[model samples]
Target: MTITCQEILKTHEHLWQEATVHPFLDGCKQGTITPEQFNTWLVQDYQFVVEFTRMLARILSVAPRHHFDVLLGGLTALKDELNWFQVKAAERNLSLDVSKQRTCEEYSQFLESFARTPYAVQATGLWAVELAYNQGWQLPGHIPEPYTEFADRWGNLGFTDYVKLLEQQADEMLGNASPDIQKEAEETVITVAQFEKAFWQMAFNAT
Candidate 1:
């Protein structure tokens, strides 16, 4: 079924809320993570994101012409995160290539599966990605001290623009959607969110 943008946003909101409870965030904020561990996590995250982005691009290919601008814009904004990942890799003296690092196998598999799947699956996959990335911005300020480091790292000035762009896209998609399209979008959002959380859980279990 074709998914609407609004449904995608709602599903993302739910996913972000769930992410707040993830142990990965807890571990980051708790300072339980060594630099090495953080590097490993970053590499795995990049691997997942790279594959997800390709999948999103494919889905965007078939997006409604009316919704195309916002959807593509959102995708473009997210590409900046790749630079962040590269920087993190440099700091850790690690390679950005997934094959080079001991990347999380489950996350890698999820990305590949999401990318290779039919366009019908794009809505769910994209929704999960949007929820996770955007939620990174909306997180509460009360994050534990250990995780606080990432607040600045992931929540930089440029990231604010990214958040605004994403929120705006979500608003536009939801606001302009027909009732039927909205429902489909929401379902996609929820499905994607489930995948988003599962991806992290997969990573956490990996460690």
Candidate 2:
């Protein structure tokens, strides 16, 4: 499965497309989600997000110094999201329980393990995350009610803001990469799109 970065990206694409795009669009249309529900979702899902970011950070640590900066930038964005999460929690007057860590999906476990492996392996995982973050901005448009709590909570700022930054970093990295590495990163983007779908599926179906 880890034969080449391109192969891994291809492996991850289809599942990703299906899982994320539909429900996200639906949620945006319904606009019934409340700030409190959004907070509960974040609090329940926080561990997966943090772990996911950590895995991406580990992958960034392995890139060539120039390329490494892009990954580092992505990590910074992830941290920014955490800050947003904290602020949102405070806004809603919700207490984040440190003891009740969220359960991770199997795919999340795979990402954490991939981050601990050789550089190439970790890089593949990083690509998935980077690609997803970069491309996810396109889906929010599908959301219908812009004024509802769901829209206010998710449809407004955080995801798109983070995505633009992620895309810019990806563009920089792609522009600077050597031919071989560039090919790998391209493949990584495709893989990430697939993973994005899987992540959404995990979220939608989570108990």
Candidate 3:
């Protein structure tokens, strides 16, 4: 079987399951996540988003000409995403100034290290991070009231399509990559998946 980028990612399905079905997400889906827990996640995630945007900018700087528009679209989306975080924080009386948790710090470092790497590896990392959230929240069943907004932000069709586009882009990049680049890209995916689990664990711990 010819292994594709998504197939390489799926090889770590166990880790993805641990990440997507985490207790934190379960709490969100049930509308039972405490304010403190939600705030912790929101604030830590805001920190991640800041780094994520930086990573996206770095990727944009190095992405191939063919991939420019799609990457730019993602960069544009991050601006609104940051605004949404701020708005939601204010509505919940939550301060976005909360310190970054250990997981967030580690994940930020991981993403930052890819700043000048091959675009294929960067795209793989991006796909892994976004897919983790999308798959986690887009699970079957209604998301309860308080968390519906959060779910929709990540799980909505627009975001779903965006992730799919990223996936396709990553696969295209990987298809022409050298063997070493392909190996590195798969490693990046697994590492990001592990980070996804740690991120969820950090949120659950705050509860």
Candidate 4:
């Protein structure tokens, strides 16, 4: 049985909704989130990105030749993301070094486990992860001032287009994968969605 990324998303659409729609994002949209809340989440996300960058590198090492350009470009963006975080942190008087919260550590471990998975599995999983952020921030429509940058960075036209490319890549990879690989990829999306949801709650609770 062949599975496309769309089918995987459709099958777990409820879980996807759970991960993407949350009070945290709602707060962001409403402009009710305090600087402390936002900053805490930003710091945690920076740490998450650090691990995410590592995962991207490991997955790229084993990625198919055709995937080289997209995956490599993703790494470059991630590098810029880290520097962006530092610049933002300095503006807020926030420190980049801090303890990883329970959810962040668990999420990191979850991402790490995918390192040895098949390329199809990793690519599909990566798509699910990015799509959550893309939709999560975009779904809210109008974001007020101050917080617009956060949503715009991930939800803007450029990022949305890039995510579509990722979707196409994952779908192409899964189309040629074994049934077992497809099955694992579906499961990987579910697991990643769970972490995404938890990470949002963790950030919200910090407020």
Local accuracy by lDDT, each model = 0.57, 0.54, 0.86, 0.90
| Runs with alpha carbons beyond 4 Å of true place in candidate 4 | none
104, model 2: CA deviation in Å? 2.5
Worst 10 residues of 3 by lDDT: 1-10
Please tell me which model should have the higher lDDT, number 1 or number 2: 1
Give a tens-digit lDDT track for model 2, residues 121-187: 3454454564453344355555444324434443445555644554554554455556666555555
Output the lDDT of residue 83, model 2: 76
- Superposed on all Cα atoms, model 3 deviates from the true structure by an RMSD in Å of 1.5
**Which runs in model 2 stand beyond 4 Å of their true positions?**
1-13, 34-37, 98-105, 140-198, 201-207
Give the distance in Å from residue 49's predicted Cα in candidate 2 to where it truly belongs. 2.5
TM-score of each candidate structure, all chains considered together? 0.62, 0.61, 0.95, 0.96
| Lowest summed lDDT window (length 10), candidate 1 | 99-108
lDDT of 4 by residue, 61-137 (tens): 89879888988888998988899989989999998889999999999998999987898999999988889999999
- Cα lDDT tens digits, model 3, 151-183, are 888888898899999999998888888888888
Model 2 lowest lDDT segment of ten: 1-10
lDDT of 3: 0.86
Considering summed lDDT, which 10 consecutive residues are worst modelled in model 4? 198-207
In model 4, the Cα lDDT at residue 128 comes to 89
Cα error of candidate 1 at position 178, Å: 11
Select the stronger candidate by lDDT from 2 and 3.
3
